[model samples]
Target: MAVSFVQRRFMSNALQKWAYNLSGFNKLGLMRDDCLYENDDVKEALRRLPQTVVDERNYRLIRAVQLSIQKDILPKEQWTKLEEDVMYLQPFLKEVKKEREEREAWNKQY
Candidate 1:
């Protein structure tokens, strides 16, 4: 079954938070003093991270974020910010899907 955009949005937010927490050790090595969750830039960067890094915990966080967005849990401006990040990724995802289909068709011939 196809997943809706809302589902994807939720997944993305959760994945981002999970990845952020998991990177704590890595952050230590980098010697950054800023807290991951408190920093807007850090959070934004995580939100933009690729799907390959997303894990279960983060997936859940994203779902929560999506639910919050849908229910107006956060302020309207904050929700808009989240939407902006998701919008940025739409084109890239489309390209990836197109390539996957091409690859699948080529394999079918053999």
Candidate 2:
């Protein structure tokens, strides 16, 4: 028996979400994507985001940093809720990765 794509994705997302909450970055007003290291793919994704989104991401990071230095997290009311912490950069990253893979595959065809 083989697991289906949707099922696999669902399980993977569940685990990811569980890990995200367990990591507690969201408690400090940081999204899961914010915790991602600044790799080339993430940089590309950030470049593709709209100005407003970029500003918001910056604000979140700054706030998180301030909270860390102060030895506190955002107030419970200010903490990023799990449902609200969407993967804003993931779609763009996926697109960038797909393009990279396609380019690699194309180059190999020569």
Candidate 3:
């Protein structure tokens, strides 16, 4: 059972790496999280991010846009590696979602 679990984990990681590379956003120096659609949840999460992280995100986005306009990708050595693509907004997003759900529940109780 443990062996199967390990195999599955390895396969899942491989598949994720394959899909990440295929997405091509890394070529523009953006992380996987940076490519997520900026819906309400994402916007709120971004708003809650620390200033430094927010600035870094904005920098990456602006650079990506510039590269796109020039029809170019980042240098191969500068691409975002899958290992470095941390889900920086996930904690904030989770908090926002939990609060929203609690608010909804309270409204239902009233």
Candidate 4:
């Protein structure tokens, strides 16, 4: 049972890695988080990010757009590796969602 579980876990991670690489966005030097759809929560989260982080995100996005327009990809070495793709906006998004939920609940109570 444990062996099967381990195998499943390994396969799951391998599949995810394969899918991540296949997505092609990383080839343009964009991170997984960078590809997220900018919904209201994401917009709010982005608004709450620090200026430096926002600048970096904008630079990456601009560069990606330029690369797409040129029909080019970054060098393989420059691709965003799975190990380096951290969820920088997740905490902010989570906080925003939580605050929104709290506000909604308060409104319901009033």
The 0-to-1 C-alpha lDDT of every candidate, in the order given, reads 0.47, 0.89, 0.91, 0.93
Give a tens-digit lDDT track for model 1, residues 1-110. Answer: 99999999989998976665455422222112222353444444445556654353364356555765676343333332322223333444456557667988999997
Give candidate 2's error at residue 6 in angstroms. Answer: 18
Positional deviation of residue 64's Cα in model 3 after best superposition, in angstroms: 0.6
Candidate that scores best on TM-score: 4
Among the numbered candidates, top lDDT falls to 4
Regarding lDDT, does 1 or 4 come out ahead?
Answer: 4
lDDT of 3 by residue, 29-77 (tens): 8986788799988899999899999999999999999999999998999
Better of 1 and 3 by lDDT: 3
Off by over 4 Å in 2: 1-20
Candidate 4 lDDT, 1-110, residue by residue in tens: 25798899999999988999999999998987788899999999999999999999999999999999999999999999888898999999999999999999999999
List candidate 3 segments past 4 Å from native.
Answer: 1-9
lDDT of 2 by residue, 2-99 (tens): 99999999999899778867888988899888989898888998999999999999999998899889999777798787778889999999999999
Q: RMSD in angstroms, candidate 3?
A: 2.4
Q: Rank the candidates by lDDT, best first.
A: 4, 3, 2, 1
Candidate order (TM-score) = 4, 3, 2, 1
Which scores better on TM-score, 2 or 3? Answer: 3
